[model samples]
Target: MVDAFAEDEEPISLPLHASSDEIGRVFNEHAERRSATLRASTERAIRDHFAEAHDGQEPPERIMR
Candidate 1:
């Protein structure tokens, strides 16, 4: 499952007797956190670009939508 995220460089440590359900729950929680982080980063980048384009002013609401 770690391969799914290309996280081969990082080792995942779990209880040796971890069940399938436990592993799935951990994977899902990790994926959700990663998704939220990526979304925030992308939004920040977009806001920064628009701010620069508008001389530090916020872009139009329509354009943002």
Candidate 2:
């Protein structure tokens, strides 16, 4: 699992006065950001794998089907 806070970042703690909706928004934003990061990393790994196996040729279009 990915760490919530990076080396220079601080952990988020909700204040006692935080509303339910405000807390939900914070969780949603964090989830979306993490999802995007994972998507990009997955794409890079797939491309690298194809490149090594295909001797630098482009991956076949059929792979997407």
Candidate 3:
């Protein structure tokens, strides 16, 4: 399992006797955190692109689409 992560990432551990529900909960929490991080990063990238294309100001909402 340690080989699966990068040097800076920590390996996750579950109780030796963990139930299926417990394992599912752990995976769900990890996925939620990863999803949120990706979403914020994507938003930041879009904002940066719009600002650059619009001379440091965001374009009108309709044009964003």
Candidate 4:
């Protein structure tokens, strides 16, 4: 049997579905954020989610693997 402790595979790259025009249109119609600020806010949200989920905990060596 393969070892359970063996190294995990790396993550795959995700594809974003929006074209420039489509993204611009959506953002313009809905979001109150400018493009640069929207990007920063999105990144901050992701970081916050990860931080809160993993806070004060010992994660697996390959937690998301």
Alpha-carbon RMSD of each model: 5.6, 4.3, 6.1, 15.5
Q: Which regions of candidate 2 are displaced past 4 Å?
A: 1-10, 60-65
Return the top candidate by TM-score. 3
lDDT of 3 by residue, 8-36 (tens): 25356799999999999987887677667
lDDT of 2 at 17: 96
Model 3, C-alpha of 8: deviation from truth (Å): 9.7
Residue 5, model 3: lDDT of 25
lDDT of 4 by residue, 1-65 (tens): 33322422333333398687877776564433344455666667767777799897654443445
lDDT of predicted model 2: 0.72
Better of 1 and 3 by TM-score: 3
lDDT of 4: 0.54
In TM-score terms, candidate 4 sits at 0.34
What's the TM-score of every candidate structure?
0.67, 0.67, 0.68, 0.34
* Whole-model lDDT per candidate: 0.69, 0.72, 0.68, 0.54
User: In lDDT terms, which candidate is top?
Assistant: 2
Q: What C-alpha lDDT, on a 0 to 100 scale, does residue 22 get in candidate 4?
A: 76
Q: Which parts of model 1 are misplaced by more than 4 Å?
A: 1-11, 60-65
Order the candidates by lDDT, highest first: 2, 1, 3, 4
